[model samples]
Target chain A: MIIIEILRYLFGYIEFRAFGGFPDRFVNLCTKEGIPLWNIKNAGGRITACTTIKGYLAVRGPARKSGMRCMALRKRGLIFFLKRNKKRVGILAGAAVSVALIFILSQFVWSVSVVGNTTLEDEYILSEFEKYGIKVGARISSVDLKEAAQTAVTENEKLSWAAVNRKGSVLVIEVREITVQPQMYDNSKPTNVVASEDGLILSLDILHGTAEIQPGSAVTAGDLLISGVIRHRDGSESVVHADGHVKALVKKKETFSAEDFSFYKLSYENKRKIIFFFGIKIPLGKSVPETNFSEHKSFLESGEMQLPIGIITQYGAVYSEEKTNPELSFQDKAALLGGAMYAKKLLDYSEIKTSSVTEKTDEFGKHYEFYAECEQEIGRLQEIYVEKTNDIA
Target chain B: MPKRKKQQNKRKNTPVTPFNPETKLEMLGNRELIIDGCKGIVDYGENYIKLNTGTVMTGVCGDGLLIKSFDNEIAVISGEITEISFVS
Candidate 1:
């Protein structure tokens, strides 16, 4: 039935009203004559039916023989529709052209994008793509992406790997740069190894300089521990950069005091509010009745695409200080303060070897003295300037 | 007397043939009727439609009867079909 309706719509059909005859005889004549007619109805001596244009034309003879008068009521289907809208021919033409244009444009690259490139610039990679004739507006069928990527990698020494891929209308080039390691120090320059801090020397492993201090030797800060000047057998000395590791035992001391009295404890209560507009904040209502409060403002962004208008949320946290008495005994307070000072002093050392803490109480307050012995690197690089001697001297 | 008996026996053994020649009538509920091998339309009306199928005349009684299609020796009549009967 759907196929028949589609055929009717495509081939075109006409609906007509028949009068002045026996409608049954008219239909019989039409059927017997092989003039296809359907949707036939009779009302008050008037008959109506629909048929294809050819069927309607062929029915004229049968209609006459049946003593029926025929008058077309309406025309339908594609042929009649095109004839009715003949004035808007340009619209159909434009639609056809746009379809063709889209098909043609999809076959070519519209834009070029570069990804995974850090040191290499987009323009540089695009320029390499241009050399391979794989830039924007290039035909996708004509471009060999594998060969282009290989060529790009071969041409640039800094690029370790490169790949060219076409994603719909975009030509993408992904590249990775070659990583270079740092160079070692120059040996021809003169440099000295000095003590980084005041410590007792533990050991020394000189790689390119003469050791001026031995184990158990005490050195102060800025004291030279190794000399970069090497005296040769020809009675002349040459300068070189010194490179070695020096380990020493350093002592650190820190003092802390605790008061045996009540202290103030601050409690933070937070409230949030949102504001719209740039840099202008209007408080909707008071969050808390506390007089002391700090507000942190942050803008809410929808996505990666930045828009000028945003929602600013102000997070206000009220800090109220309440007086509270200490809950620990005097000995416990002294031990806690001493342990805290010990940890603070240990932060400056690489490794702690031994530590001792002593607590002293006076009329002022309880005092904690913490001492720590640590092992650490004590070498600091210091450049030595050589003086040019005159030959006459 | 034996020949008459044989003729009666032959008549009893033979199968009866249908009156109409392969006319296919299909009814979809009470709303539509499709008739194949249709000869022509005998009468058309909103209340009833009579169709000729070479060997018999079929009358369809309905309200708002419409011949939806008539082609290739087939007729599709649609509407609220109440009854269908053979007039001849």
Candidate 2:
């Protein structure tokens, strides 16, 4: 039924009224002539009906023969509708222009986004893309995205994999950075393992070198712990990189003095004030009185497009200094000062085996002395350059 | 002459069968009626509509009888139909 209605609309139709003469005879004549008519009704001496435009034109002859006068009341359908709204041409023109604009804009990239990059900056990736002619506003058809991605991965040593994709007007570049591994010295070069610090050798393990020093041997800084020069069976010598781990007992010492100290205790007051400007906030309360307080600032972002304008809140706390008086016996005070000195010395050693503290008093001041024996790695790699000799044998 | 008279007598005794024309009538609830193979409208009023179907005449008695559509041999009638009857 809807298809028939649409067809009627396409071909155009007419709603008409007939009066006078014999209405029944008029209907019979219309049906006989195959002039389709619908929605026919009679009220008093008048008859109303709707028919196709062609039928309406053909209907006049039958209507005349039946002695009825017919008059079309209205014309309907797409053709008549267009003719009625012909003067309003701007609407149709605007629709066409908008469709063309959308098509043209979609063929070019409006923005470029970079994702999955950590150490490599977005600017660096964008610059690389620019070198390959893949930039914002560039025609999508002209850019070879696959070749661009391959170039991006190969040009940057930090990137292991890279992919480029286009979504509507946006071009996205995704990159995966290579993980860094610990540095390993070149084994092909001749190098010696030497003592990094002065100590008595506690243990030694040589994997690819001759031992230059034995356990319990005293050595100073820069002394060779393992020799890269190897003695062959034929009384000849060959140089290879030395690899070894040497643990040594190193001694550390420090001195401290008993003194009055001042410590800062920090507390925050809840009082705050906020001033907003263009979605950004400027806090205008009391400033921190001392430098010992911690400050926390938070920024609130706005809009789905992530506009730079946002609210900023600054939280501050003030610190007040409290002087402390020493309330310890003579020996206890000396031990307290000695512990402080030992803590400072411990940073230089990996592990402390034993320690001792001593105190002395003089006219200058009361002093505490501390000493500790620490175990630490003492081997350091040093490259050896050997001159090339003509004798290959 | 006797055979001719018997034939005439047989013809005279036979009953005349009316022409049976194809007519389709569809009623939706008590609100609308669609008549196909309609020949013409015999009578039309606010409360009643009578249609000619060649062999028989169909009449619809309603509260507000209206012809929604009529084209070719089809007619769509809509109203509060109270009764439908055929007049031979």
Candidate 3:
């Protein structure tokens, strides 16, 4: 029904009234001739109706036969519009050129983005893609997106998978980086498991080596816990690689200080804005002297598509610095203590079993000392040095 | 000829007669009447509208009666339709 209405609007329709004769006979004659009409109304001895352009022209025969007449009340549609404005050449040319400009502009990429990458920098990934003809202002129809993604993956060994997708005028490059794990020491080498810290050995499990100390033995930081020597029944000694987990009780300490706190007063300030379009930067005002500045960036976006137009705002401020005591409450001081002992860094490789804290204050600021007893894996591989001597058996 | 057969023969012989696959009248809450399979507009007036529904004449009595369209044998009449009656 909407399409019919639109067709009627596009092809042009006429609204006219028939009077002074039988209007019903005129309408029936129109239907008999296979002409379509709508919005029929009867008022004050006249029947008004709407019909298409062709129907209105052919309706003269039916009107004369029924002894009625039609006068086109209004003419509307695209054809009529063009006829009315055909003399204004400049307006028509300008409209045509604007449409053409939008078409050509949409055919080129406006922005490029990189997503789904960690460790690998966004600029580095973008540069890699730029080498493969994926960049701003490149013709989208001519660029091979799949080939670019494949070559990018092949060229960068760090990337396991990569994909390139175009969203309107914005080019999106998605990448997955390879994760490499640290390798352990070679197992064929003859080595011993030595203690990395001073502790009482809580438990010990040895693999490919002989036990040097029992669970209840106390060992220093450099003492060996697993020995690589093996004596056979024939009384001959052989050396093997040492591997073991030795859990021991270890003590750690951390300190936090507030002596570095300083306050600053603004001496002078300036705000600068730079307008950018399609990767071209144009400063809107004079550049200020370089100082400590907070920067903000915003881009013009249409829905989810980012246009290549943006603005950079810089609030440059000069300040006079002065040393001052930190304004903190008792709870704030205690919360800061949680980070003071960088000693909490031990939780990465050890579990804290017990802890104690000591606090001290000076004219500069307050200080905290954190002492903790932790269960830690103390055994680490150490190469054994031995002489190759010729012995007669 | 049988009555049904004679009617079917008349339909096949007339090409300009409106197709009568089915006659349906949908009344929208006494406000509008949409009629399908109408042969033509028999008579049109402000208080009353008459349509040939192929099998019988369908009359819609109302105030401010207007025919929205009479194309493809479908007539959509909208007004404060008070009553609808069939006149053979």
Candidate 4:
């Protein structure tokens, strides 16, 4: 119904008042003529109604026969509006130029974005994309998306899968990282199980060799816990691959000095924006080198079509990260423990049985001491490096 | 829906009427009245509106009575209707 009304509005219509004479004769004649009319009211011997433009033109003969006159009260609809504004050439030309400009701008790339990347940085992905013609202000027709995706996956070993999809004038590059599986140890050769760190043996499960260290016995790094040599009751001896899970309590200690902590006051003196258009960077004022920056971008967009022309604002914040002794807080203890865990491989080993920490902050320096006693699998496979000999001598 | 039992089932009690295209007068709770197959307008006024329905002359008495539209033998009258009478 709304669509029909719109069509009627586009075709144009008029409201008119028919007065002086037999109005009923005019209405009956108009109905017989099949001229559509609606919202008709008769007051003071005058009939007011709305009719289509075609109906109004055909209403004269009926009005003449009824001795009544219809004078158009108001004219409405699209055609009438256009006729009213036909002399405004500048406005019409401007509208035409704007539509054409939008059409032309939508043919170029407005921006580039990276997705599906957890570890790879957006700048790194975009830099890689630039090599394949996937850059802003570049012609969309010039970029070979399929070949670019293929080359990206081939060049970057970290990415297992990659795809380039176009959304209006914006280019989206999605990537999937390769998941590397842990390597398995070969057991065909003769080997011995040795301790990886200083630990007191709590439990041992020897797979193919005899347990050399007894439970509750303390052993340091490089101490053999399982021997590959297996002696039979018949007085014959043969060597086999020695594998085992040797759980032991290992103590580790790590410390952070005042030299490891530093503080920096933000220097906004080096802050300035460097605008980049397409692949070219334009400096609006004096430029300074910066270690990091935050970029904000905007482009003209109509619906999903983004215009290639846009502005990029880059802020240069100077953070020297220079070493200066400032008092260390509990956050430093976390850094100390993190360093200890990385060095001692505590998390990969096993759960901690006991832990303790001590910290000191003074004019001399800040110090953090971290200690942990954790039960870990201390058995490490060590190849038997002895030469094979048939002579007992 | 399930079939009713013999004792519970009963024949339709209302008579079925076929389609009738003669002049028909319908009143919308006395607020409006629609007269189909109207021949011509007899008198048009704020208090009274009369129409020729071939077989009878129908007069609608109301306040601020109006002929909303009249075309192709259908007259749609709307207002605060006080009475409706037909004279053969």
Candidate number achieving the greatest lDDT relative to the actual structure: 3
Question: Worst 10-residue stretch by lDDT in candidate 1 chain A?
Answer: A304-313
Candidate 1 — what's its lDDT?
Answer: 0.79
Clashing pairs in 2: A37-B70, A37-B71, A38-B70, A39-B68, A39-B69, A39-B70
Q: Name the regions of candidate 1 deviating beyond 4 angstroms.
A: A98-393, B1-18
Model 1's TM-score against the true structure: 0.40
TM-score of each: 0.40, 0.37, 0.55, 0.50
Docking class of 3: acceptable
Give the per-residue lDDT digits (tens) of candidate 1, residues A302-376. Answer: 453222234444444445443323566666765666555544553566788987767787887667676878898
Q: lDDT score of model 4?
A: 0.80
lDDT minimum window of 10 residues, candidate 2 chain A: A299-308
Candidate 2's C-alpha runs over 4 A off are A1-189, A200-207, A214-223, A258-279, A282-284, A287-346, A354-357, A362-364, A382-393, B1-88
**Regions more than 4 Å wrong, model 4:** A1-79, A86-101, A111-123, A158-162, A174-184, A201-216, A226-240, A244-269, A274-285, A290-377, A385-393, B1-88
Give the clashing pairs for model 4: none
lDDT of each: 0.79, 0.79, 0.82, 0.80
Q: List candidate 3 stretches off by more than 4 Å.
A: A1-11, A16-24, A39-49, A64-73, A82-94, A110-128, A156-194, A199-219, A222-275, A279-297, A312-393, B1-19, B22-37, B45-49, B58-88
**TM-score (chain A only) of candidate 4:** 0.56
